[model samples]
Target: MNDKENRSRSRNETSTRTGMGASRPSRRIVAGHTRPCAECGLVDWKLDDSRGEVSCNSCGLVVEENVIDPGAEWTNHANTGVDRSRVGAPITHTLADKGLNTSIAASDLTSGGASRNGISARSRREWRRRRVIDERSKTRQSKIRNRVKAFQYIRDRSQLPSSLKEEACRIYGMLSDEGFVTGRSIAGVTAACTYLVARKEGIPRQIPDLAEKFHVGEKELSRLIRGVSRRFNMHTITLPPQFFPKFVSDLELPPETMMALDGLWNTIEPHTDIWQGKKPMGVAAALIYKAAAEGGTRRTQSDICKVANVSEVTLRGLIKQIDGLLKSIGSPSA
Candidate 1:
């Protein structure tokens, strides 16, 4: 080629590559088309997912702005972030269908003005029929139907938190899978699982309380708990005496009464005779009553008994036992 033609071709190539007149090379480019920062001369660039920018990490300068983020847009406040995800509620074992089943609403279709594109009476009837069929289909399997009923009972009757409910449902499923539910009633197994989970999570619900709630005999429920514990190799731990302070506080006792209860627990905890084979709730109630009386809180025996759900007789018995122990230790009695 001629020298003039070669020079023109080189200039054209440089202009195309640099997007500018061929005066100098572009500073944004490096070896093999790598882009470096114009401010700090650094190759390291960070993509800000939140702000949608490519910024220089060292110089706090944005190398490129308005970058598109290929992630879900989310809003976070305080410690919680709202997941505006396309996916629905997470799969949970508590539901018979693991929460994947869709629901058909039976409310008035025209309630919302969007239903101005009205449906005929015949279509409405067909939808109602379809809703019935969907409902029936959910309980097509006997076991699944039983699980649904059991979950409803647990939720309505147990008054447990959702976390404990989910855990109980999981435990029931495990028991059913292991053939532990073959001869056991669904209610019994579910109640046992709920009690176990409450104890495991330290939520403070007692076996007798759950039994009374479910209308199952306390002896029967206790038997089921023991059986389930053995079958699942579950280790049940007794709630410590330290749990009494919360119970005392829940009784609406004053802070001084709570402090007095704490001191009483520390003094009497070494004496198991005072609480041996006794319900922790009863022991806690007795201690609270004693502490309140000592602190001049004017809480009556009947009042303490009602809050603890123990009889007045039991309360007096526990009080007497605690009072004796206090005297033996040379501590003044309430």
Candidate 2:
């Protein structure tokens, strides 16, 4: 009788300590999974997630305490459900300062903000002066000034997508810091990075177009392409087939034409001896023009040349080489 009374008292004390307010009347099922409790030889364990405790249901003995939770921290989360992420903005390499800048809004110095904060006219003028100095401090160094100039040119002048512009500026920043861009025109280096990034990522931008866009000399940018390739130890030759996807998209080739291009390259790949010294864009333009004609699209050579920025003679020369290759390979389609 005394042991039964003691057990009843223990259960009441444990229930009061847990304090799970109006959760549920039914017991949470935790039987047959864990070893029997030491106090009572029953596997009826009660888990209190609110208090992070596991206890024996019969004897009210705490079997485990302070259990760790792997989920997000519990607060008013269950009441008002929203994912409140505890993190800051992501870092990026597109800026001279790499996204660490904090700008003071000029509107904050307006009459409304001043009245709210009880700020005076003299205080606003003083903060404005401080903001100007802060802005100048970001470009105080010569190298920083150079990076700002190159990145600004990329943002304002280049036709690259926003993601590609980030990649191009990051490359320019790295090369400029490592002296690869030393004694080089800033515009030329920026253009070279943009072109190489486009080519490397299979975007197929023409060097002449990039030079005109970035306001740099074509020959100078081409020379630097070789140097940049050498610096990165990237010795792979850029072939004409790499240009097909972009050129085909520009000409709006059909699905059949895309497939024809695949088979066409397969026949041409075996005859590397013929197409080895050819201009890449010219060859790509000729092949695309031929494939489009075979697929019943019939894109004009002049239009293909204009899209590729290749002269008609260059396109014809590549087509003539393709003719000879087809003759030697005995391709019935050609």
Best by lDDT: 2
Clash pairs for candidate 2: none
TM-score to native of every candidate shown: 0.71, 0.70
- Predicted candidate 2 versus true structure: per-residue lDDT over 1-334, tens digit per residue: 7866765555455445335674323234453336655664455678787687878777788867876555665345465776444343456666778887887777888888876888899998898898888889888888999998999888887778889999989888889879887788899888878878877777757888888987888899899878887787644567888888888888988777778888888888877876777778887888898898887899998899989998998888888888877887789756
CA lDDT, every prediction?
0.73, 0.78
- Please report, as a residue range, the 10-residue window in candidate 2 with the lowest summed lDDT: 23-32
Error of 1 at 166 (Å): 1.4
What stretches of model 2 exceed 4 Å from their correct place?
1-85, 105-129, 156-163
**TM-score of candidate 2 relative to the true fold:** 0.70
Q: Write the per-residue lDDT of candidate 1 for residues 1-334, one digit (tens) a residue.
A: 4755754554445435444555654334312325645554445456766676767654667766767655664544354666544466679977877889898776753334225538676677777788889999889887778778887877787777888888888888877767787777777778898888877876667666778778788888889999998887776656336456566666676778767777888888888777868877788888887778788876888877776678888878888888888887898653
The superposed Cα distance between candidate 1 and the true structure at residue 184, in angstroms, equals 2.5
Report how far residue 154 has shifted in candidate 1, in Å: 2.1
RMSD for each model, in Å, please? 7.8, 7.6
